[model samples]
Target: MMTHIVSKATYRTHMIALFMCLTFLWPCAICLYCTDFSRNVDHYCSFCNAFIGTYE
Candidate 1:
């Protein structure tokens, strides 16, 4: 019975770790996607250089 309880706790910990990993990696994936989009926009925009110079 103690082994069974420990097994369940281990399972829960594994799941929590998986969820945390996904939570962290998913935002990085989204940021990369957005970065790609922004790069595309900068490449296409005629006045992008001017805008970046003023803002950044």
Candidate 2:
């Protein structure tokens, strides 16, 4: 059996990439959804504000 080894740095990079992808996925999906149905202006604005981590 041939075993492949992954270095710590490579593993760390892959983990960070995966984490970033998952982290942004939800906000982006919500943003796109809000964009599609922008009839509710307040709803869109709130989600966008939440995405940017700011609320006024």
Candidate 3:
């Protein structure tokens, strides 16, 4: 009985991790697909962008 419960809990934890990874990465993937970095950099200059662009 305890083993069964543990297995079910483990399965649920794995599913949640999979969902979180997909949710976080899906937007990043879409952004990469839609934008060319050079064009995007000029138009999308937030403070963070300027910092990274200048430093890197």
Candidate 4:
């Protein structure tokens, strides 16, 4: 029973780490593909256009 609880906690920690990595790395991935580093008036990349649009 204690081992099961420990395993569950470890699994949750792994998932949290995975989520953090995705949250950080996803923008880096977009920036890597971007040609223009300049930000528009809204402070987003002009080359990529929209953040949501990038996902699509």
Off by over 4 Å in 4: 1-9, 25-56
| lDDT per residue as tens, model 4, 1-56 | 11111111234344545665688865544443242232221233445544322211
Clashing pairs in 3: none
How do the residues 1-56 of candidate 1 rate in per-residue lDDT, one tens digit apiece? 11111111234344545665688865544444334322222222344333222111
* Residue 55 displacement (Å), model 1: 57
Write one digit per residue (lDDT tens) for candidate 2, span 3-52.
Answer: 23222223434454566568876554444333422222221223333322
Local distance difference test, each candidate: 0.35, 0.36, 0.36, 0.36
Give the C-alpha lDDT of model 2.
0.36
- Give me candidate 2's TM-score against the actual structure: 0.28
Better of 1 and 4 by lDDT: 4
Q: Number of clashing pairs, model 4?
A: 0
Candidate 4, RMSD to the unseen true structure:
20.7
Give the lowest summed-lDDT range of ten residues in model 4. Answer: 1-10
Estimate, for each residue in 1-56, the C-alpha lDDT of model 3 and write its tens digit: 11111111234344545665688865554444344422222222343333232211
Clash pairs for candidate 1: none
TM-score of each: 0.28, 0.28, 0.28, 0.28
